[model samples]
Target: MAKTFERGISSIPGYKELTENMSIQDLPLPSELIIPLRQHIGAPNRRLVSVGERVKAGQIIGDSDAAISAPVHTGLSGVVREIGSRMTQTGQMEDCVVIEVDPEQEKVKYTADDVSHLTKEEIVQRIKAAGIVGMGGAGFPTHIKITPQTKIEYLVLNGCECEPYLTCDHRLMLEYADEMIAGARILSRVLDNAKVIFGIEVNKQDAIDLLKEKLKNEERMEVVPLDVKYPQGAEKQLIYATTGRSVPPGKLPAEVAVVVQNVATAKAVADAVIYRKPLTERIVTLTGDAAVQPGNYRVFVGTTLAHLINSTGGLKPDVGKIIMGGPMTGWAQKSLEAPIVKACGGVIALTREQLAAAQEYYACVRCGKCVDHCPMALYPNYIGMYAELGKYKQAQEWGALDCFECGICAYVCPSRRPLIEFIRRSKRA
Candidate 1:
C-alpha cells in the first residue's frame, strides 16, 4: 500500500505514522577512534598533532587556515596512533587521526551556572568556542551560519524530522525541550535579534506538546506544527512552509531574511553557549528491521558502526544492509568499517527483506510520479536519464545542481529507479 501522511498543509502530503524513538542498543566503545578533520563543508582541517601525541577529550587536534573552517578535537582521551588517508562515505580519501582510547579517560562536559544572566554576545562566543555546526546533516559551522551580513527578523527552529526511519530530532524535541528552546533563543540573539519560530511536522505531537510545556513563558519562541512532509526540514522548504517565503533558487535562506537551524543543532548551540561544552557527542537513532535493539542513543563522534551495532545486541543475522542518516538522503554504506562522523543523523540496520526489496531498479515507465513529488518541481526522470547518459553540463542546464538532492522524487518513484542517485553522481556532490 502506498502510504499517505497528513502534515497539516496541502502541498505537504504523504506520511502519517512516523515511528522512531527506539532506545534498545548500547554498543561497546571502540578501542581506537578516527576523527576526521574535514567533517564540515568548508576546507578540511589541517593536522596539528603528530603520531604518538596524547590528547584529552575536547583538545584541538586539527586546525585550518580557512575562516569558514572549524577545528577538530579529540573525542576521547587517547594517544594519536596514526594519521593517514581513510575512505570517507563520499568515496574520497582524507586525513584521519587514529586515537587509541584509554578507556579510563575522563569526560569533560561543558557547564554553565545560568544562561539568564549571560549577555548575548557572551553566548555567541561560547557557541563559537564550542565549535558548533548545523547538525541537520550539513556540517556547516553553526556559528558562521548564524552570523549574517544583515539583520534577521525570523529564526526557524527545524523540528521536522522529515526523513523516514529517523527520529533523533523528534526524540530531542520531546526529551530535551528546555535545552532546545534555550538554544533557539541564543541562536536568535546571534541573528541580531529575531523571534524564534520552532517548526515541527504535525506528526510529532508528543514533541510538540513537550516543547509547548517547556516554552510556557517563551513568547519569543513559538512552536508551529508543520504539515508532515518529506524535506519539511530542508532549508528552502522549511522557510517557505513556515514563513511562506521561498528562498530564491541558487540563493540562501538569508536571501529571504530568514535563518533556519535544526532542533538538534539548536540544542548543540545551547550546549556550547550556555553549558560551555564543545561539540563532541550527539544523539543517534538506530532502527530498521534487522535492528535487534533499536532506539535513540547519545554517542560520541568517531564511534564505529561495528561498535554501535554490537551495542544494539548485534545486528540480526538477516541484516543485509546498513544505511547512514535517514532513508531519504541517507547512503547505503559500502561496508561496516565506516565510523559515525559529525554529519551522521542515524544508523539503520536493514533486514534482508528490506534490503532485497530495494535491491533492483527497473526502467522508468514515464509515469511522472517522480515529478509530482519533487518539492523543487523538478523532472527527476529526465534528470536521472540525462545523468545516466553522462551529460553533466546538460543536467546543470536543467538545474541539476540546484536539486538539493532531497530524494523525494526517488522516494515516490514507482519503478524504484535511483533518480536521486543519478543526480548525485552527476552533481558529484
Candidate 2:
C-alpha cells in the first residue's frame, strides 16, 4: 500500500498568501555579523582572515581542504573583530568570524557573463568562491550537488514548502519562477542535460500553475504535482513521490543515482553562476499570530531575528514562542538575538494561544497512528517508547536519526504523543 499522511492533517493556520511583488523592508545591515565557520554539514572551515583584517564581499575568509566542507565568505565587507566559538542557531557553541562592516559598503562587481557562456569548471569555481550553500534549510553546497558523478537522470526541484505556517518558497515560486528556471538550467547544464522535475504539492496549485504556464515551451522541464503531505520536501520522499524510487535509509539519494536540490537552493546557484553574487541573502517567511505584520522578506544572511522583528513592526508583546524554520522541524527558540543563518527557511512568531497547549500532550493510547503515518515505516510507538525510556543506543537501532521530524506521526496520534520530540530527545541524549 502507498504511504500517506492522515486525513485533515492540519496545516499551519493563517497561512495567508504573501505576495513577493511588494517592496520588502530591508533589514538594518548589522554593524557586525557573526559568521559561523561550519554552516554546512561537513567539517568547519579553517579561518584565514585574522582579527583587524579587512575582507570584501565575496572574499573567502575561511576554507577547508575537506571534500565535504563548503567555504565561508564575509557577507558584508568588514574588518574581522574576532574568530572564536559563539552560540549558534542550533543552540551549540561553534567557531565564528565576527566582522564589523565598513560604514561605506564595499562594492563587488558581477561581469554579467551569462551562465550558458560559462564552462562547467568556471561555474563550479564561481559557486565555491561565492560561498553558495543551500539556502533552503539544507546548507549543502551548490557546487557539490550540481556535479553528478553518476549518469544523469531526473533533476528534482524541491518547491514544496510543506512545513506549516511557512511560505517562503511558495512566494518565490509564485513571483520568481523565471529566475528559478534560469537557476534550474544551470544545474541541468552541470548534470549533462538531465530532464527537470519541479515538485510542488497540490496545496500550492497557484505555484504549480505559475511555473506550468511559464515553462510552456521547456519540454524537458515539466512540473510534477505531488500529493500535499508532510516531509514531501525530503529528498528520499520526494524522489519516491515524483519518480517512485526508495532511497534506502542511511544512504544519500545520489547513492541511488538521483540529485535533489531545493528550489531556493537552485535559485541561489543561478545567482552565483549568472549574477556572481555570493549567497548572502535569502527569502525567509516571517509568519504566525505574534508578528505585527506577518509576511515574507528577502533578508541578508547574519541579520538578527530581533532586527527582522523590529523591521516588521516587532513581535506582539505577548509572543509566546519564536521558531526558526518551518514548525515541523524548526528549532523552538527563546532568544531574539539569533542571527538568520543561511539554512533558515523561515522565522515564526507565535502568540501564546498559537503555541500548542501542554494539556493536549496525552499518554500513548496504543492507537498506532504514529506507525501508520511514519514515511520511514518504523514503529514510531516502539521507537518513541524506547526513546522516552532513555535508551539512546536502542533508539538509534530503531532509526531515530532517520526521523525527519515531519510530525505526521504526532499529527495523527489520538493521544497527542510527541513521538518526533521523543526520538529527537533520545538522539540528543
Candidate 3:
C-alpha cells in the first residue's frame, strides 16, 4: 500500500498532463543572463567578477566564505555587463550579475573522475564546487545537506512532484532514471552506505515501476509508492510517510537520522561526482492554460521569465498571471523581467478565467477546515487572525513559525482569508 502523511488535501488537481509526457527540451541561450548572487537560503555570496570582465560558461561568478552558502556560476560564456539589484522570482530585490552572452559560445567542458577511488570528502567538495543546491525549491546547499553531522539511516530520494501544474521532477524521473539512481548510490556511499529509498507518489506509476525494475537487482535500495497528497514531497512529510518517523518542530531531518534529496538534486550529484559538471541548467516545466507551447525545457540558470515565455511562442491573449514555480506555493510574478534562479522548477501562465478572481476576505469564521487539512497540524486560522490583528506574539504562539506555508490553509479557508500572507507577516515579525 502507498504511504501518506496525515491531514493533507488529496483531491487537488495535478494538471500534469500539460507537460508530464513532454520530453525535456533544451532552451537556447538567451542574449543576456541575470544571475542572482544569493539564490540559496543561507549567507549571501559576494560578487567575484566586475563589469567588463569576461567569463566562461560554468565559471564561478559569485562565492562566499560562509560554510552555509553555495557558489553561483554563469551558465553561458559572456562578458559581465552589470552588477546591480533586480527583482528575482522571490519578488524581492536582490543583487544580480548581468551578463551579455557571447554569440560564439562553446559548451563548458567537464572532466570525469573515477568515483571508486574518490573519498567522501572529495565527493562533497565536488558537489560544493559544482554549485548544486536543492532543485526542489528549498534551495538549501546540497553539499551541506548530504554531509549531516548525525548518522543517517536512510537517504530518501523524493520523486513526488505533488504541486499542481509542475512536472519537472516527474520528467526527470522518467527520462533520467539511470543518472538519478547512480546519484542516489553516490549519496549513499558518502553517508556510509546508508539504505536508499525512492519515495515516489502513486500518480507517477510509470516512474515508480521503472525505478523498481532498475533497482530490482541493486542492493540496499528500494522504491516505495506514496499516496497522492499536497506537500507529499516535503522533506519532513516525505520522511514521515516513507519511514513512519516524525520530525519534531524546530528541527531538521538529520535529527531523525534521515536525509531527503530531490530527484533532480540527486541527478546533479551524479553529474558532479562522475563528470565534474557544475549546476548551470535545470529542467523547467513551462505550462498552463495560457501557455502557447507548454512543455518541459532544460533552461539555463538566470534566464528571464520573458525569454522563456517568448521561446514557447509567447502566452495566450487571455493570460492573467505568470507564476515562477507551482500554483500552490510559487510566487506570482509582477514582471516577466524577473530571472530564474537555481531553485526554479516551473513557469505557469494561467488565463484570467483559470485564475481565482480576487475578492474581499472576511474575518475567520473559526471553522476547522484549515486545521483539518493542514499537513503540518498547525492552527492557521488563529495564526492568521492574530497576525491580522497585529498580534505577532499571539500568532507565533499559535504555531506561525511551525507552518511551512504550503497554502493549504488559504486554499481550504471558507472566508477566503490569505492565511499564507498573514503567516508570512507573522514569521517576519
Candidate 4:
C-alpha cells in the first residue's frame, strides 16, 4: 500500500452528486471573446494581430520569444475588435485581444498527413505550437515540463480530480479515455519511454476500470488507484501517492526525475501531436445549485462566464458567489464577464445557501486542528498568526510558501480562522 499524504479531508458534502451520470455538452460560441496574452506563469506573449485583423481558429494571436512562455491562440475565426487590458482570473490586469466572432465562420480542422513517422523533437515542437499548459490550473507550459534537465524516470498522469464540485477531469477520463492513453504514450516517448502511471482516485472506479482495460497491452503505462481526498490531485501529493517519491521543498518535479501532467493536458498533447491542433478550447464543468443546468462543457477559450451561464439556462436568482476552478482553491469572480483561460478547469456558481456562512475571525486557542489537517505538515495556525502579526519572515520559516492553499486548514478550523488567507498574504509579502 502506498503511504498517502497525511492530513486531508475525507469528504465534503454536495460534490459527489454533480459527478454522477454527467456527460459533456457543447457550449454555444460567444459573440466576442477576450483572449489574455499572459495566460501562463512566465512572461506574457506579445500581440501578433492588431484590431481589424482577421484571424482563423487556432491561429496564433500572441507569442513571445521568451523561453519560459507559451504562445496564445484564438479559438474562433473572427475580427479583432480591440486590443486592450482586461482583468484575468488571477486578479491581474493583462493585455487582451477582443475578437468579434464572425456570424458565418467555419472552424479549422487539424489533420496530420503522417503521425507514425514523428520523432520526439517533432512531438515537442507540436506541443509548443499547440500552446498546451498544465490544464489542472497551474498554467505551466507542457512542452517545457516534458523537456527536463534531469533524466526523467517517471511520467505521472494525474486523474485525481479531488476538488469539490469539479468533475471536468472525471468526465474527460470517461469520454476521452483512448485519446488520453495515446497522449500518455506520446509523452512517455518524449521522456525517452519513462515509466508512465495514471493516478486516479478510487472514487472514479469507472474511469480506472476503463483506463486499465485500455492499457492492458501497453507495458510502460498503468493506472494506479488513489485515496479519495482533497488536494489528492496536487502534483506533489499525486507524485507521492503514485511513486512514493517525495519532492524536496522549493524544488521542481524534475529534481526527483518525475514529470507530472494532468489527464486533460495529456489528451491535448495527443491532439496537438497527432492532428496538429492548437489548444483553443477545453472541457469546463459548470456546476452548483446556482447553475440551471449543471454539466461539463467543451467551452472555447475566451468565452465569458455569462455566456456559459446563459447557455446552461442562467444562474438562479439566489446565487451568492461565482468561482472559477474548484471550491477549495478557485478564484471568486465579481462579475460574469471574465473570459475562460487555458488553465481554467471548472466554473462553480454556488447558491447563497450552498455557500459557507461568513464568520468573524477569533484568536486561535492553540488548537492543533489546523496543523492536524495541513497536508504539508506545516503549522498553519502559527503561519497565520505570524502573518497577522506582520512577522512575514517568521511565517516563511514556518513554510507558508509551501502551502498550496488547499484550504484544509481553514476547513477544519473550529475558530473559523482564515488561515489560508493569512498564509497567502505572507507568501506574497
Q: Which number leads on TM-score?
A: 3
lDDT of 4 at 382: 89
Candidate 4 residue lDDT tens string, 343-370: 8988988778766565476889888988
Enumerate clash totals for all models, in the order shown. Answer: 11, 0, 0, 0
How high a TM-score does candidate 1 get? 0.92
Per residue, candidate 3 scores C-alpha lDDT tens digits across 30-88 of 99999999989899999999999999998999999999999999989989999999999
Sorting all predicted structures by TM-score, with the top scorer first, yields 3, 4, 1, 2
**What CA root-mean-square deviation does each model show from the true structure?**
3.4, 2.8, 1.1, 1.5
Error of 1 at 265 (Å): 1.1
Worst 10 residues of 4 by lDDT: 1-10
lDDT against the true structure, per candidate, is 0.77, 0.78, 0.91, 0.87
| Error of model 2, residue 231, in angstroms | 1.8
Tens digits of per-residue lDDT for model 1, 1-429:
112232212443332223354532344667888777778888888898999999898887887777787777776888999999876655567788889989786757555767777676677667766777788898898768888887788999988887777887877787777788878877887786697888887777788778778777877777787765677778888888777787777888888899988888888888777767778778888778788877788777778777777866888889888888877788888877677787787888777886677889999999988777777777888888889899878877777887887877877787889888899888983
Pairs with backbone N, CA or C atoms under 3 Å apart (clashes), candidate 3: none
lDDT of 2 by residue, 1-429 (tens): 223333324344425454323334456667777788888877788998899998887777788998877877777888899888877777777888888888788567766665567887897888877777877678887788777677768888988777777777887787778778998988888888888999888777778888988898998998988766677777788888787787877887877677898898888777778888778778888887788877778886767787788877887888888889877777878687677888897888777876656336777888876786687787778778888888888888888888777777876777878877898898788
The list of candidate 4 runs beyond 4 A from truth reads: 1-3
Q: Candidate 2 overall Cα lDDT vs. reference?
A: 0.78
